[model samples]
Target: MNNIKSVFSINDLENLSGIKAHTIRMWEKRYTIFSPNRNTNNVRFYTTNDLKKILTIAFLNNFGYKISKIAKLSETEIISLAQKIYSDKTDSNFAISKFKLSMFNFDAKLFHETYDKLLETKDFEIIFYEVFIPLLDEIGFLWQTETLTPIHEHFISSLIRQKLFAEIEQAQKNANFSSNEVYVLFLPMGEIHEIGIILVNYLLLKKNKQVVYLGENVPMENLTTVVHHFNKVNFVSYFTVQPEEENLNTYLDTFHQNILVNSPHKLLVLGKQVHNFTSFIPSIQCFTSIKQMLNTI
Candidate 1:
């Protein structure tokens, strides 16, 4: 019980719901939607339940339901309405809301259940781009604002990583590796964000391409082993951080000089940090997304 986060500020509510703090306060005064409690410091705080209810309300309101109408419905009715949207239209918004609810409540069951439901109607790639990516993007903002803790972030990331691994395993069974260009995936040294690269591995494997997933904070020199082994290779990475903007050009120069200067191998990259890159030779390419990389290779 001590590990549970039981309360949230209005700012937390805003960050999670994508609703304005002013709008939430207006909803409170105009309707009986919230009854926030005061802490010892007299700061207004809401329960986990309040956050859930607000998320549901926001979900419903987004689909043309008026707040005045939503205010009159019972909690069950509101949730039923939200559920009906996903049921009838297969709305991604409701799934995103359900995921956020699961994260807040630490409900692994709900997370899996929601994911399984999505799988019934959508392919893994669609679900990933539509549901998971947007949720992760919002989660990043929420964490930056202190609306969520590391515990919450880790809980959801672990769940998603589990799914990625499961899917990657399935892809591995069908991998032919007949393509001459063997792909090598890794994160830069001093970098630890690996979800993107793991997904890239699964994507390549799904296409029957060969991939060697070195994974998470790999030094540049480590590539010599694969370089020595595979005659044709495409070294892939997703740079969320590490290789700071100031160091990006220098890092690219070093990698090109050492890894691809005279060799036939190439480097393919995807991530926000690559926008910091200045210039690169034809052998070194940076992608804005996994989709773009797929289209190219």
Candidate 2:
């Protein structure tokens, strides 16, 4: 038998649910909704169940459910109501709510079921371009608004990474390496966000292109070495945060001077920072979207 006594401190709740500590305390005092336990020292602590309850409540509140009505529901009833709300076909709002619920509950089964249902009716491209991308955009907004925390982001991102990896593996089996142009995928130094880069790699491999993925935080000097070896190379990277806004011009100038200007190959850059180089970007080739980049190659 497993112990059900694992306690989560108020900090844990804040970290897991993105709800402010003061706000959670106010809710506790103002309403009889959340009742956390006290340790031997009389310090309050929450449970996994409490985290789930708060997540459900937050989701409902975001969707315009009155806090008064939400506080009246029992735990079981709350879960059931969340499921009903998630299943309604109104819009992407419901899907986003369901995805958040899955993250809060750590319910991989629910995540997979919801994703598979969407996949069944829509093609993978539609699912990626329409559903997954929009969901991620919403997640970004929630994070910025402090409506979701790092824990919530990591929980859902890991699941999405798993799905991407599975698709990549399947694509690799059929990928053709006979071509001379090998695409090298990487993220610049100090940049660790690889989800977008990984998805691009998956798409390239799916299209039967040879891809060499150096992953995150790759040094520019090391990339120069790769350029030397591959006779026909197209280097790709996602520049989310490596180069600060002020230094973006310098970074692009150095890249153009050192790599793209002289080399016979091309360098494809994406992400928000790339917008800084719009004027100076060489007509050789630059892409803003994955679909456009893929089409070019």
Candidate 3:
């Protein structure tokens, strides 16, 4: 009862392995690296084993091993080579390749092991700032280019979110919580992306500050109600895709006029949409990046 699906298309292979369909076809014809099965209607399809093999081959190719050398290796030999590659401390490409393979196969154990190994030599903040953020950005690009599907993005993001949440929880457990200025982190209505806001909450909690996280798609009106009760509350939000560009100015204007103008508390904003009104943005300190905001705090 493994319940694993078998058949996959060329596009699926490309998405899972990061090997272009055209390139895969070329490898098949020119190098005989892979031999895919054809359906009755002459459509190319690959199996689970084929997907694993291609990922292993892609990992080897990324590590400077020529395609010819990769093709000559037996399946057992390829697995052995991947195991050896995983042990190399200097090979970030190998680690990233293994991470991709884990994501493709939904192998959480492998993902955790690889991340833990990386953490032994690199700090979590460095990993987050240098590796994970860039990887997520690349994932976004892949999504835009139709190289990955929503399912692929969601699966990987969910795993990352789990890790972030665990770290946040541990930080909260050790927090001193002596601050009077409690931050209330939230996303405005229609904004379901909460990863950035979650990270901010984590940062605040790590600093031992009280954080009230009202996660994703929160109504602005509801936030106003909370602000009325919590006098020491500082409202923080991330605008990734919510409040469409056309309406961003209106939203900010209303928010500034109603919530920020008379209130003693401050509003901290970040993400791409914040740039839309940079010229018209009030003299109040609103950060454009997490680093800027963290420095101010």
Candidate 4:
């Protein structure tokens, strides 16, 4: 709790707030929204307070609140209005800001609070797609830009995983796997992203389909033993940065021959790598999104 970053650069602000650095500078010049503390070298940087205020403003701005009017309000008024907007739950931007702050500060309680607040007006699936997906997408770019450390990613990811587990557990209490085809969820070898797969698992369970979650970085050879357990099954996988573009088709061919040949089983593919898929096999299916896959299956 005490070890989170105390300072951020303009680029960091741009990335986190979704406001360009020039706009931030213009806001400062025109409205004097928040003062940035300059370092010894006279470079512009922002304190954690500046970040919180920007997120608050951005939350409202995205929801139709004007910056000109926002600049006219007192800090207390701004916070109070934000709270009212939250209570109304008309937009996910407020929740997204809270989630981002939780990730940056490594605050589990804040994450849970935000999730609970969203749950009051939204179902788990709505919250996942609306708030969580955008937050996760931003964090991915933030990590790639070196604006956030892996530790930051892991901390927030663990909190989200906890919620997913809780949701999945609650759904499982009334387990009904009456579907004819069993679903096996996994990620390809060398792929470590598990959040998408877990979300899919939750949805599949919601559909009353039996699911065998093999998890991330699963090798092709290791799946034979599991597939033999079900008479007819669908292998669901998310391909996020595991099989390189050049090797993706080869990987698919290997899976088709090794696992799906002359069998009633099929493979369902999801994730970013599916965009490169030019041709299709009879048994292998690629979906553009989780919702599409859910609807199709």
Candidate 5:
């Protein structure tokens, strides 16, 4: 079956195109840029074709094209202009914009093509840091602001995760180090976000360290067992949404009493929830960002 998106709401367009829903309504009302189908309840719905057209319109508008002029352009003309913008190799922002289009269309081909083209001039790390990271930040903002849906976020995140895992597997195969420290990565219970931890795992492998990746939603009770098994263990975790502000200290205290008190190990944490604590458990280190964590690792 084709993965083409056949139905969309105004919010979907707003999320995918970075155009406000109010502005989209204005374009539809004033310039007839979109001819949406309304349901019995009078809710607006759009087809995949509308999605494509709006993506082009948004891209052109970003380039200073007037809405009045854009509304008059033929479909072929708009598509040609979009293709030109997509092919502009000098604009890094265009790369991100194209990826947003791909996410909206569920077009994996577009994502792969854009990434491969970028790899011609830069390595994966550079593309990730410069393009993908900023793209992710935008996606997060869109999700938070209710402009993007979970489906849209998941589509892009899953593709980027595949690349991260591929790199990690390759690194693991070639990794050889004499360091006795074994890094164990996991997400706390109730916390399902693992991309940050996965990236950290990749970084650890790249630095020639051994990583025992337990993955997401690991039980806190298991940490003691893991530490007991390894001679020199370094527990690494990402707290994206787990361990609520009130529970953060309690969780750390649990780890302090159960794992660190009896073992000779260190805890390194990275996430948005790390700063809510007034104090950290002994032997625990909190990082504000990926770069800070990478520097210490």
Candidate 6:
């Protein structure tokens, strides 16, 4: 809990709040809004309280309130105005701020409320691209910078996975695939990142394609067994932290020999590792991002 409430540098605030450090400094000096503490080296930092205050102010500012006007309002008044703003309507930026605030405090209510509010106006696809994607990208940066904890990461990710699963189930009920093409989605063995694959499943369902979701860390042989049974199999995998960087090429070779050789199956791969490979064997397509894969799908 203490880790979750830890302090953040000015740069972190800038990253998390989408406010420039220079602007934050100017507001601090002119409006006396946030009283951040300074370290022994005179480097300034802010507490969780300061972060929440800035998020609230940023939220209000998005609703057409001027910085000067926001600085003049008391914290209580700021909260009041923010609540009103939130109740009426919100955009992507406001939704991101609310999501960040919820993640920081582990406040499920705020997270659900923000998501529910977005659902009132937008569909699942709109929310995923506009809200969840940006929020996840920010969360990744926060994790990289040590501003957020594993607990925080898991909390938000689990909630999102739940929503994705619900949406996927709902979409799958009415799938209308004309072709017998089956998409077999999974992460490579030793790779555990399934969010990319999960999103792929959702998109494939939206395309009304048959999806055989094998999910995370599936073995190459298991994939082969599954593909052997299907006449038109499109094996998709997200290569996040697997296929050992030193042996990525070797892993691809093994995958090709075992899965694609003498078979009509096409392998579609994505993630950080996929970028490192300069070339791929025949029938193997490497995608840099989900959007690129979406085009092919």
The C-alpha TM-scores of every prediction are: 0.96, 0.70, 0.82, 0.94, 0.84, 0.89
Global lDDT scores for all candidate models: 0.89, 0.75, 0.77, 0.88, 0.83, 0.84
Q: Indicate whether candidate 4 or candidate 6 has the larger lDDT.
A: 4
Which residues of candidate 2, in runs, are more than 4 Å off?
Answer: 1-93, 279-285
Q: Write the per-residue lDDT of candidate 6 for residues 38-151, one digit (tens) a residue.
A: 999999999888998888887787678998898877899998888777767767877888778887778899888889988888998889988888888888888897777888
Error of 6 at 107 (Å): 1.4
Clashing residue pair totals per candidate (backbone < 3 A): 0, 0, 0, 0, 0, 0
For 13-73, candidate 4 gives per-residue lDDT tens digits of 9899998999999999999997888999999999877888999998888788999999999
Tell me the tens digit of each residue's lDDT in model 3 across 209-283. 899988988877777777767767778889888788888778877777767776687778888787544635452
Mind giving the per-residue lDDT tens digits that candidate 2 earns over 28-48?
Answer: 998877788898999998766
Query: What are the clashing pairs of model 2?
Result: none
Rank by lDDT (best first) = 1, 4, 6, 5, 3, 2
Model 5, C-alpha of 178: deviation from truth (Å)? 5.9
Clashing pairs in 6: none
- Lowest-lDDT window of 10 residues in candidate 6? 1-10
RMSD of 5: 3.4
Q: How far does residue 6 in candidate 4 sit from its true spot (Å)?
A: 3.3
Model 5 reaches what TM-score against the true structure?
A: 0.84
Badly placed stretches (over 4 Å) of model 6 are: 37-45, 62-64, 83-89, 276-278
lDDT of 4 at 57: 91
Ranking by TM-score: 1, 4, 6, 5, 3, 2
